[model samples]
Target chain A: MAQFLVEGRELVAEAARGLSALALRRDDAAAMEACFRALHTLKGSTGLFDLEAMGQLLHAAEDRLAALRDGQASTPGDIDALIEMVDQVDRWFDALERDGRLPADAGSIGQAAAHRIRDAGGAPVMAEEQPAQPSWRIPPDFDGLSGIAIRYVPRPDCYYFGDDPIAITAAIPQVTALRLSARVPWDSSEPYDPFTCNLVIEAVSAAGRAEVEAGFRLVADQVAFAELVPAAQAGSAGGGPARRTLRVDAARLDRLADLADDLVIAKGGLAELAAQAESLPGGHALGQALRLRQARLDRLAGDLHATVGRVRLVPLAPLFARFPRLVRDIARSLGKKAELVVEGGDVEVDKALVDALSDPLLHVLRNALDHGMEEASTRRRAGKAEAGSIRLAARVEGDQVVIEVADDGAGIDAATIRALAVKRGVLTQEDAARLDDVAAIDLIFAPGLSTAAAVTTLSGRGVGMDVVRSAAASLGGRVTVTSAAGRGTQVQFRLPVAMTLIQILVVACGEERYGLPLDAVVETARLAPGRVVPIRAGWAFQLRDQVLPLVGLGELVGTRRAALAESQRVVIAKVRGEPIAFAVDAFVDRLDIALRPMNGLLAHAPGMLGTTLLADGSVLMILDLAELVA
Target chain B: MTVRLDGAVLRLEGSCHLEDAESLTALLQTSGVSLVDLSACQSLHGAVVQALLALGPRVEGIPASPFLRDLLLPALLVKRQAKPSNL
Candidate 1:
């Protein structure tokens, strides 16, 4: 990923945001003006660097926007083409960054994209969107027709299968004519079923039959081709978003992180020396001076972390922007009228977190749209709006970022989940039946439990709710689903804002020390023996009226036997939703440590989440409660 | 297909397909007030019709093919939809 230069990523990401902003809110005059300035600035910047082709291409795009801004002409209102141009430029920039030079075909690519920008500047003509109907009619036969005639009928569940028909058709080579129409009748516009696709697309292309067919090979069976007789037909043309970034070599940033870490360790060592000096005869004054210097070092370390974090921070808009297009297409595929609403797209998170979050979040939204979101008719019948909505929202919660994908559709039924759990052999019928609603709902996070009845194109290809849960967990985060039968489902992912240099609560268990995320530590308490109670096979301690579960640190980590100490010493940690008290030898001082995820064979070691180095040069194994409790 | 975007007019020669719709629309958009000369056009794809319709360009030199002529003229013929231009 580092090979893709940071500057290239920044340039592409910023341009993509601006282009999408213009595309999405064409009516927002301010956003449109910003887009013009951004494009113009990018063009001028590229020209300054002597990237002639890029500068020229962006100039053309800016010209169109200039016309729109000047009110010289109406905006073309084609978001797809504008997106394609910026996306193409992004690829070109990637090639330039990787090879230290632009590809030989850069000129042609830019010229082609320039034409698209022009087209995108055209006025709006396509307004009414009729639902797809079964169109088996022979493709239009026109005079002097000299290319391949194609009729593509996408599978009703193509969206589930992760196939985008719009993109596929839009990318066809040498496209001459494309007619996207609904094959299905408009009987129920009051509450349209968007999930049920009744649309068929027929296109005429100047591209050869083979090129077009190869492009549609994913759904070959759904396409029919009619070859025109030997005549001169024009050939096809081709074309192909990133985030805000500060241009810094990723290697240098890594080195800075390492140095900051080393400084933190060195600062700890100085404090130790200060303590030793304080013990010396007549060393009290010297010790105080060294402590002041150590305090300065600590401040510097924090500043360094903040600086590096800002350099790596990126707005969530680029990530969130991708979903609306996806949900819109998938909704169209399912014939379900679903709209994606995004909030707090301007919220910034670590770039690495954004990348890590993309795939799993996509999967969760797929489930939300397919299984979680009910049909329009069902929604209407349930006294809900006909148009179901999914929102991709993000916010900063303390030091952590909370990203949520919420839908206003049919929510999960715990009974259905339990039944599936039993049916899928995930749990015994008796066990599933004994589980409460929350526990049963959590069972969806257990692998192999898909509520979808059949393997459709959109989802139910075996990867289930547990996959979504595990993905969040792998990022040192947790996912929770709260649903009401008729309401929608929200899968919230709570993750630390930064992956490096987090504050951890160090604890000692006998001879060994371990680290736990400070955020997870609710409180530390020394309880009396009488407060500990045995519940079933496990032990619980009464915190207030509620009894929290208790786990022995020595027993959970398999290091030592649980000693029957006279006093119960413990730290209360939040595990899932419940607070669990873990008995430890003693609580050590809290320290800001950079935890490195355990890799290779030890990565999946039971109970260990990650490992961090202490000032004393010893390794502290961070514990994962899910693994510890299991 | 040949696309000429410079000069006082944007020119398209030979047969053009739906795939070229974006390029053609772009040519018209970036061309500003330049006339889209399609007189040498042997055939025009359906997507191009929509692209041209959106732009409402002054399409010069209408093609001889009835298939294109019928679709092209009706869309560009409506003066209310297109800008005032000499036919």
Candidate 2:
């Protein structure tokens, strides 16, 4: 039943996409049929359960789509109606899954939808107006390869509408068994109305679903049709899509990841044990055996860790799909027109990161619409197209997934940003003057800085770009902002591909050790005395031809530092595409560790990632190198 | 629902559920012939389908239900051929 609901949801979503294309000037029959198939499949799946209301709605939707496919013209409102129908169905399914039943008024709501659909006819003659087709009648002794179970409950007053329930049930094709059931317990005890239907005609037919449904077309809303598989095969009869995907409890996946982490730590212990055993006299034999076993265990643990990580990997399509509707609705409300273009949305990322990303991406996109993009008149004056284009693109770059949200409108004015920074007291007047265009634009990410002349409903609610930057940083990513005054703005969020166990370059500040994620580490340098250039707040390392600003770890994190030495260990990292180096007291061993996020109040703390235990039992603080540099 | 037995012939009516399977199997075992009239039987549980297959009953006046005629008839015929011939 869960699988049926999932497949039904997906089918509705797919049909939504198909409907979008069809309504956008597509006159092809294939588009109509695609929607028909989606609705038909949903109806069949709904029949497997007691969701008669869902089946009825899907049946009507299928009929409407079938009419369209048969050369009937359609109205634009008809497409909107279909889309609304799909949305309602999706919500109903979600409610069903969440609450174990549809909302209390689902039946009435379904009836209203049915009426709306019936009125949305595009045919020269309405399907309902056609002479009532023969209700399916079962033929005695006819053999059906597969059985279809049906329960028909026509409206009590259906006979007044010239509808006969028995005639309908008897018309079912290839029936091997039939029953008309009536029980006092299953009905009201009031004296039966001879004119009203108190009968529920259940039948088993061997005919195909389409035929059976066609036979009961008049009372589809009041009927339930189940395709019965032998009890032996019923366990597998839920259908094909359910067999391909599985629903796993999230807690189990987390427990698996935690156990994998324990295995890694245990493997590390075995290695330490092997090293200890190798030193004693006459311990070589035991040490050799332990080392060999430890090596195998190391490989097994590595495999387990990677497999556990993949379990959390899901495609980014869900996140990407919501943006189109968002942009459309937001644009319409703002009295602007914009089209959202998504590229490379098939990239897969850890589900946790994707879930955490929704708010940040929403903020960025809303910001693009409200603050970044110019009004239609302004865009036209700037020699750009009247309709603004916002493109959300993503791709895997090295070990990072870089997602960019770009807009074509009047971009940020760096001078205005600088002036705003000073006005907001985020930067002093003197510092504001020293800021170049790049530096001025970077201040957008500073907390409490907003250039909005007045607060707007869409974006300027006190929460600014700083929130987006912090959110990206929480995912071990950095947001890079760039804009040309009249061209547009592009904000890129470069995030780690996976947030599970990661390799880090462990380095020391003074007595405290910090780990730098290896993906950010371009190279380590041993700078000579002359190779260091004094900067305003720190030293710059002159490596080859590039002059990279070097931040002293001790000063950066407020830790104690050793006295200046003739040489220093520095790690050069790529932060927001700029090469910056950080000086540490000494370099430690590189290792793979599972870093969990800091808990409670410490969670909001910036710059430092979570900590993990070292082999020697000390905790290693992992620094968000990008945040630290910022 | 009850089965009416007369000599080697029996008639089934109304709806017969799975609980009736044991009695139906017993009747087929004792009754010497497999001709059971199901013309008036409106519904049969899936267990009845399985029983009909195992018992290999020669049902005369089969119920006039498309589902029963189409799905169960083919299944019943296939089951009868494979029903060990002596049942």
By lDDT, the best candidate is 2
Estimate the Cα RMSD of every predicted model relative to the unseen true structure.
22.7, 14.0
Residue-level lDDT of model 2, residues B8-84, one tens digit each, is 87777777655555567677767776788778877765434435544557876767765556544555565456545
Candidate 2 lDDT tens digits, A1-630? 776765666677667767877887546433554566567667778877888888887777777776665446676677767776887787787688899899989899898887787678744235432212225543232223236667776675665676756556657777656554331222224432344444555677666556788999888998876544443322233344324556687789878887887778667888779878988798999999999999999999989998888888877876776676677778878899887787876898888878888889888898888887788898888888888999999899987898999998778999999889988899999999998899899998999987677778888777999999888877878898999888889999999877667889999877788998898899998877777777785677667888888878777788864544688788888987899888888888789899888878888677878888776767788888767767
- Model 1 spans > 4 angstroms off: A1-30, A33-246, A328-339, A374-388, A425-443, A484-487, A499-510, A516-552, A560-592, B1-87
**Can you write out model 1's per-residue Cα lDDT over A29-120, one digit (the tens) per residue?**
44553455445555656765667888777777666665554444454554566666666666666577668666888888888887777777
Taking all chains together, each candidate's TM-score versus the true structure is 0.56, 0.60
Evaluated against the true structure, the overall lDDT of model 2 is: 0.74
